[model samples]
Target: MSHLPTLNTDTIWAILNEEIDDKIVNQLVWHYLGYRYNESKQIWDTSAVAEEWREKYPEPPDFIANRPPTVQLTRSIPKENKQLLKEYLGFKGYKIGEFGPRQTRRATMANWLLSYLKEKQMLA
Candidate 1:
């Protein structure tokens, strides 16, 4: 009887730039480390077993059992493609979020932005 609200690429892009905020990032890190979000507390509650696994493994899961290899955000994407993506997003009034100590994942952002632009035909 419940329905999930429909969301468009514009909304998703906005959420990516706006709603995935610092507090949310911390929550995501905690959840990725295996804690569940506590709605009332607005925090993630860590489990002992999750903490143990994290201590043992320390790194995030690199692959899914039956899925393609993860996208390499660290690899350098071509500068021309990168600039095209930025120009498209800027034309559409979308601002990219700055992340990380070294800002290494801009390639992934570029990919998403360009795909959205192409989908919306804001880019030729």
Candidate 2:
């Protein structure tokens, strides 16, 4: 299983200062603040820290904002298999054109639609 990269206070600070844009500082700050009774003193005042940062800098867009929504399957599948899967998705009426210009690939579009369908429990 893939693990989420650990974001330290320093790293978060750097992100807030525009040193990096890999993660959304606001979301991370909210998540940290939501953790009630965190034993770590460093992460204790996440809300205040986040507020200060927000006051100084405009909120940055989420990293996945431009990407099509999809389940990121890590397992390596053959290109031919993926193409077949895309064809199947197309046959199911999940058109790639609906998601906009960037989402032209069948693999990405199909996976995104499938992921949405699965989330709604529409697929068995």
lDDT of 2 at 102: 30
Encode model 1's per-residue lDDT on 1-124: one tens digit a residue: 0121123344334434554433333233233335454578875345532554445434433322211212332122345554543464453433367344212222244343455345456554
Q: lDDT of all predictions, in order shown?
A: 0.38, 0.35
| Candidate 1, superposed: residue stretches over 4 Å from native | 1-9, 20-71, 74-80, 91-107, 116-124
**lDDT by residue for model 2 (51-118), tens:** 53345323322323333112222122334444433353333433555654232232343343344334
| Residue 107 error, candidate 2, Å | 5.8
Clashing pairs in 2: none
After TM-score superposition, the amount by which residue 83's alpha carbon in candidate 1 deviates from its true location, in angstroms, is 2.6
Runs of candidate 2 with Cα error greater than 4 angstroms are: 1-77, 90-109, 112-124
Clashing pairs in model 1?
A: none
